[model samples]
Target: MAERVWEPGDRLPSRAQIGQEYGVGENVVRRAQELLISQGVLEGRAGSGTYVAEPRERVRVVRSSARQRVRVVRSSAREQPSGSPFRADMNAVGRRGVWESRTAAKVPAPAEIAARLGITEGELCVRTTYEFLADGKPVQLSASWEPYDLIAGSLVVLPEGGPHAWAGVVNRMAAIGVTVSHAVEQPEPRMATAEEASLLGIQKAALVTHIRRTYYSDQGRPVETADIVVPAAHCEIVYEIPINR
Candidate 1:
């Protein structure tokens, strides 16, 4: 049953019914059911019949469509013209999204960040760390860095502050005459670090999807880079790439 007949959420047949079908005694059927449950294939509910357990695996959806759909949806969100992409994504799935952020300026750019932004190590930068919640539960974390030299004096430097609050990388950079021409993202699935696990409220070394995203200017300069961490159990990272036919 575990190998072929039953699915992730299907309830097992009654012991007697299974015994009759398989020509086995009830005790034999009961032992088999217990073994399957212990092996993580089935679960028992109090006062309710046993059920199949939900698989603890990631669900991946790769989109081979136009990326323009994202921008279109962002513009058409009637009430909040500047609503957060995070909130929009959650609302689409009937969930509420909120994020808390702490921003620090004048920090030295870390080594990996410097490479992504094409800057020297120890260069002054602004870092904003965000914890995104869905229905009041932490589900994602984003740590973003931008070279201080680029928008030092502008209000956009304060990511969650000023008039452009919750404004995305594209709009915020545009305020300083740096039109974001494109963004590149690389997603990898790996075990979460101790810090990430604590922040995301999951177990240490739990499965997670790590995303490295960089925004670029029309002149092809890297303006900002971010490390986005999402809990595998709660998030589904989707990509909508244009199919070159």
Candidate 2:
């Protein structure tokens, strides 16, 4: 006989009753019940038996099809007047200061990541991971990798629990004779991983935006490569293009 569908809050049959009804051993019935619980299809309440749980909506990762327009804004009267492209709408929550709690030992770069960085297998590199929070809630997780020979001891240090401009690192690097000329960004839709979900305080199945950006120096060398993962609901990225003669 087909098992009856149970709705949310519906009381489930006792284990013994279910085993008897199915003409199966208690161990078999218990195993079936455990499977349901692990899948979030059933819940056990204190002082009560197991019950059906409301099904959760499946997370959807949708890439934005709209093209972002960049705008030019004047900085100040004293400075050489130049227009800067800015995003039309960004998340309202401000960054919750840079927290520099270094994560433990570095691991081998994943295949996809290694290709993007143009690094060889088993090469040593320094990895820095950052969690960006808004109002004490994580919204983005960023990981940056640099070859040990290039940025071993001279990396610009971020202040602990203090706010830094999003472009601060690039500017600082320029001051030290590294001229950053251009950047390339790749954005895509992806489901959140377990660690990503926990860091962003979101459901494991939640949709997220994955962005990879590589900044290059005037000398044609890669200066920095950043991988950013953000919650879909919390961010809208804008890019501006200017028609030049």
Candidate 3:
């Protein structure tokens, strides 16, 4: 690609062919392609073949809010999308953004999720998985969990259903008379799992930023928790903190 042998949008040689030319095994060629794919240098199309990917500028994700106040406050910035943070970030970069989500009711929480929600193992919860896209390319993924007992039979039970469909966690909880106090977020850098890489169109073990965030109600009860994942090569994270003298 450096020598323009495979320009952007150019289909690459098959693994067998590349291996023969390079005097390496097909597996070696495949692994090299996977690494390049993870670095945004190539893209794989199922039933087709791999191609050099177009260069993409990294989008900036600004996590800004006025949570220092007694109540958690959404950013007043007009740039902040009321519905989805993914949209906000994409908008900042002048790209169209959208997301797809699936919600499952009464799903049993795993031990790790249960601990995060302060619930017993095997307890039921609502799990919603999201895939966020920018210009039709997958850029982020998330799995959100909410305690079933808190929202059972409510109009907001299905996060993407009902009158409040697409409303975020804060607004959905607010509709049920729960006031969110603040959220705790822990961000860590890690290698992507196979599933994550596949979903995000990256290679296995690709670098990603994972954030574990939980929203707490005014009474200090955990309202919602989520695992947010973003491809490190596709986006940069920024924090906006407000200060008062």
Q: Considering every candidate listed, which one attains the maximal TM-score?
A: 3
Sorted by TM-score, highest first, which candidate order results?
Answer: 3, 1, 2
- State which candidate, 2 or 3, has the greater lDDT: 3
Q: In lDDT terms, how accurate is model 2?
A: 0.57
Location of the lowest summed lDDT over 10 successive residues in candidate 1: 61-70
Q: What total of clashing residue pairs does each candidate reach?
A: 0, 1, 0
- Model 2 has a clash total of 1
Sort by lDDT, best first. Answer: 3, 1, 2
Model 3 over residues 183-223: C-alpha lDDT tens digits?
A: 88999998899999889977677789999999899999998
The regions of model 1 sitting more than 4 angstroms off are 1-83, 242-245
**Candidate 2: where is the Cα deviation over 4 Å?**
1-111, 155-167, 241-245
lDDT of 2 by residue, 1-245 (tens): 88677789899998898888889988997777656654456666668888887764322222221222222334564322111111112221222233334542345666666666677655556566777644455656778765444544453433111222233335545535777677777989877788887787654645677889776778877766778787765555555554559
**lDDT values, one for every candidate:** 0.76, 0.57, 0.83
Q: lDDT at 125 for candidate 2? A: 60
The TM-score values for the models, in the order shown, are 0.69, 0.54, 0.74
Measured with C-alpha atoms, the lDDT of residue 87 in candidate 1 is: 65
So what's the TM-score on candidate 3?
0.74
What would the TM-score be for candidate 1 when compared with the true structure?
A: 0.69
